[model samples]
Target chain A: MAMIVDALSWVFLLTGGFLGVSGGIGILRFPDFFTRLHAAGVTDTLCAALILLGLMMQAGWGLVAVKLAFIILFLSFTGPVAAHALARAALHGGLMPLLHRAEDDPSKS
Target chain B: MRHIISLTLILAGFWLLLSGHFVPLLLGLGAVSILLVVAIALRMDAFDHENQPLHLTFRFTPYWVWLAGEIVKSNIEVVRCIWGPVSAISPTRIHLTATQRSDVGKVIYANSITLTPGTVAMRLEGDQIEVHALTRAAAASLQGGEMGRRVRELER
Candidate 1:
């Protein structure tokens, strides 16, 4: 049972790490600011949740698990609010998004 | 009255969970601090139902589970959009009318929009929210009103 639990925890940790890395790459590669926010905000919450869940499993039934749960809850609640505020600020600052229009050719227009 | 009781309980529970020390002196200190915090909150007139929201505890769990699923699905879509051709993303501004009745519900709806990948609620005025979506598909999904409906359900 202990071996199985350890293996499961490893799987979760590795997957969470992979997601986090991909999100970082997405933030760098995305074209504009808003899309980059999408990359950062979405995966940040889920990746943290997954990693903390793995840690909670490893912690077993204890205060550590409770603390991990609290952290996850806090992140989920705050992440969106922060994203909203950032987007609002950017919009107020007149950061227009680069819209992909159909009539505009990629090379010429 | 109920709000005050719930807030005090929540604060005390948080203190116990965070401290993890059962010594009499530490516990006594925790109690005093919690009381002080509650007193300040009450004096500020921030102990209303909207602020505390103890009633939504039971309704929020299922909404959270569904939201987690939505987040995972949208995250995959966003990852693909990032790796795929840049032209695939069509950034668009959308105006959505929030169907929620209360300010709390409207805030939840807007936050949920911002929480999901590819969509951000940029401005909220009255019952209308201005949003920016990374792609047309995401904007269409927001127009579908599933999340708004879920938030309305949560309000009840």
Candidate 2:
């Protein structure tokens, strides 16, 4: 059981690290707020949630577990709202999304 | 009333779990958690209906399980898009007029929209959601309307 637990923790840690990296890279490399929003969403839900679940297992029945669960609950509820608000704010601030050239052709527009 | 009790118990139990002992710590946590439960119950304009069939839990579990699979699938899709010569991710804006009634139901709908790959809920203007989708497929999925229906059912 302990070995299995250890392995699971490592797996979660690795996934979290990957997500952290992906989200970070997306935030940096993505061209627009919308694209970056995709990155940020994945990081929060997939990466962060997985990592925290792994950490919760390691914490056992202690307060760390309790605290971690609270954080996860709060994050689950708030993360999407935050992203929605950011995207709206960005749009309101004049961040026009880039369109595909063919789609952007004057005939289409 | 019911929610307050459940909240108090959960908070106190969690507090004790974190504190990892009994006596003064446990009792003190019990007092604090009870206070907090009362406070939160007041804040939400909440009522005694904590007994509502945790339908969202049961409903969204499978939806989320499937969603996780969908995320992995979409992640692969996005990676493919990013790696291509043109990085041909077509950024498109879409308007979705929602059918969900309650605020919680609307939220579940919006979050589910955000949860799926390649889409973001830009804003909720009344009953309509302004979405920025990364591709035509993503935009189409939002318009398909299955998720909204499912969330509406869950809310009931």
Candidate 3:
């Protein structure tokens, strides 16, 4: 059971790390600010949650687990609020999103 | 009265869990701090139904579970978009009408949109939320209004 738990923890940790790295790459490579925000927001919350979950599994039922759970709760609540505020601020600053065209704009194509 | 008791209990429990110290001095300090905070909150009139929202406890859990599932699903989708070709992303702006009656509901709706990965609630004016989605599909999903409806349900 111990070995299996360790292996699972490693798996979660590695996957979370991979997601974080890819999110970084996405932020750098994505075209505009809005798309990059998506990359950052998505991975920032989920990656932290996964990594903390892995740590919780390792810590067992104790103070560490409680702390990890609190961290997860805090991240889930604050992450979205911060993202919303950032996006709202950017919008107020007149940063227009790069929108895809379909049938509305005939002059472009 | 109930809100005050619940908040005090929660704060005390949080303090105990985090401090992990049973020393008399620390315990006395913790009690004093908690009381001070609660007194300040009472003065601020922050114990209203909307502020504490003890009524939503049972419903909020299931909503959180559902939101978590949606977050995970959207995270996978966004990850694929990141790894795939840049052209695969069809960025779009969408205007969604929030059906919730209260400010709390509207806030929850907007936060849920932002939490779902591919969509960010850019601006909220009255009942309408302007969102920037990473893909057309994501925009369409928001247009479906399932999240908005669920949040509206939470208000009741």
Query: lDDT tens string, model 1, A21-54?
Result: 8789888888889878888875767788889989
Model 2 chain B lowest lDDT segment of ten: B47-56
Q: What is the fnat value (0 to 1) for candidate 3?
A: 0.76
Kindly indicate the candidate among 1 and 3 with the higher lDDT: 3
What is the TM-score of model 1 when looking only at chain B?
0.94
Clashing pairs in 3: none
Error of 3 at B78 (Å): 0.6
- Root-mean-square deviation per candidate: 4.0, 4.3, 3.4
Clashing pairs in 1: none
The CAPRI category of model 3 is medium
Where's the lowest-lDDT run of ten residues in candidate 2 chain A?
Answer: A100-109
lDDT of 3 at B153: 87
Better of 2 and 3 by lDDT: 3
**lDDT of residue A3 for candidate 2:** 86
Tens-digit per-residue lDDT, B1-156, candidate 3: 888998898899999999999999999999999999999988888545357765566689889999989988998999999999999999888778988998878988999999999999988889989888999899899898899889988988
Task: Give the per-residue lDDT digits (tens) of candidate 2, residues B1-156.
Answer: 665566566666555656666788668767876797669766765554334333345467777776678666666565445444336777778788888877667777888788765788877868888787777887887788877777777766
lDDT assessment of candidate 3: 0.87
